[model samples]
Target: MLSLICFQSLITLSQIWLLAVMSILWIIWKSRNDVKFNNFVISVQRAIGTVMAWIREGGLLIKAPMGNSILDVQILHSLHLKGIPRRSTKVIPVFWHPPIADWIKVNTDGLSKGNPSIAASGGGLRNYRGFVKGFFGLRLSIQTAFFVELKGVILEVSFAWEKGWHSL
Candidate 1:
């Protein structure tokens, strides 16, 4: 049955067809796992509902241009899936203040995929006029968010000391 659905998707080449086939397979796998591990059997109707929800959510990620393909529109309409919502165009202005004269400002930041995951640290030194003096970025192994943030500051301080810009 799965092979037949995949074969049909190959023939049609419709985005909806591919989405539906993948969603159906995912629902089946999830249902099987639930029954095997948790002794929970989901109803057929519930499984079908989950597939439909997945299809709708996946449809939003499709990047088809508007009104370009009638077949795409028909498929979406038939599935009762709405197009992606448009984002607001509002913009907010931001201003940055420079450091006092004869002093250097150090800015640092860090990011991690999760609380403790692959992380990166970066920092820059700017003079009173907001001119960049030095900058550094480091890709680190698995680390906590706090550790990465502190690492960025440490790197910035060490870099400034090496450059003889001690008035930070």
Candidate 2:
């Protein structure tokens, strides 16, 4: 019975050694062949690497931009605190994005009579020189705000290209 137990232990040790060697060989082969992993796995690895790289380089707060835009955002916050009237109380902050102040701020207002005084739809686009180039005002009812915003952006971009503005 002792010999049988010894034999079982030897078998187990051999199996473990075999697994170790096989894994080493597999790793070596994978390295030599440059094995391609599943796309999802590769994507996840890239995202993780990017996050790790970002952390290693610098944290978000440190890497954040220090520019006039930041000052403007701060001023806007201050204005809100001081109860100052400003254009459009709500804001959607898009950081690390290109500025429309340099591009073209397309101001828009609309009035439709069916529900309210949205009868006057007014939209204007600014050129690269920050001058008005194009204006669009559509008087319509039952239109989603999403649609108007999208159209405004499209018009702005279109005019920018038309006026030979380079998109960086």
- On lDDT, the candidate that comes out on top is 1
Per-model TM against the reference: 0.51, 0.28
lDDT to native, each model: 0.79, 0.46
Candidate 2, residues 9-28, lDDT tens digits: the string is 33323333344455456545
lDDT per residue (tens digit) for residues 81-140 in model 1: 654423444899988788899899999999998999999999899999989999989999
Model 2, residue 161: C-alpha shift (Å): 2.3
Q: Which window of 10 residues has the lowest lDDT sum in candidate 1?
A: 4-13
Q: Which residue pairs in candidate 1 have backbone atoms (N, alpha carbon, C) closer than 3 angstroms, thus clashing?
A: none
Name the runs in model 1 displaced over 4 angstroms: 1-93
TM-score top scorer = 1
